[model samples]
Target: DKKGKYTVLSEKLTSEPMGIGFKKGDKELEESVQKALDDMQKDGTLSKLSIKWFGTDEYKK
Candidate 1:
């Protein structure tokens, strides 16, 4: 096995969208969470956090 160092020699093979899940009939909670996420997105908070963790603003795209 190559252990000291390694490099990727292929292009991206797949992509998946992430999501948030909650109980099936909790419309109030769902709406609240959705609104919160929307607010973050609108205010640039999400982008900032994404850049902080991933080093790129993947969420904004």
Candidate 2:
């Protein structure tokens, strides 16, 4: 995406891989969000949303 409008930040922000952040002890909310993401991935909604926003499925990279 060097030619794209925004510069992609290749560096990891932390030792932990990037992911959704939750409030302390928000296990239930985190699990719910994970399940939603999993469902979207299975249903192609996630890829569709990616394409809609980024013009491609970034995950394919």
Candidate 3:
């Protein structure tokens, strides 16, 4: 099941996800971000982005 653009590419070549780093005392911002991510998933925007970048909708899981 682990198949996608990265799998199709050579082992030496692969992309990585970006990590979000926030300073302390940003709970409100973090909550808003979490809500935004949830909304994006609900609206299929995340899946669209994944497909646009990876050639397949691998983020639906």
- Candidate that would win on TM-score: 1
Stretches of model 1 off by over 4 angstroms after superposition: 1-14
Q: TM-score for model 2?
A: 0.64
Candidate 3 segments exceeding 4 Å error:
1-17
Model 1 lDDT per residue over 1-61, tens place:
7786886544444567778899999999999999999999999999999777656686755
Per-structure clash totals for the candidates: 0, 0, 0
RMSD of 3: 8.5
Ten-residue region with minimum lDDT total, candidate 1: 7-16
lDDT computed for candidate 2 = 0.76
- The true-versus-predicted C-alpha distance at residue 4 of model 1, in Å, is 15
Model 3, 37: alpha-carbon shift in Å?
A: 0.6
Of 1 and 3, which scores higher on lDDT? Answer: 1
Residue range 5-58, candidate 3, lDDT tens digits: 454542335566666777788998888888998899999998999777767776
Candidate 1, lDDT over the whole model:
0.81
**lDDT for 51 (candidate 1):** 74
Each model's lDDT: 0.81, 0.76, 0.76
Q: What is the lDDT of candidate 3?
A: 0.76
Tell me the deviation in Å of residue 15 in model 3: 6.9
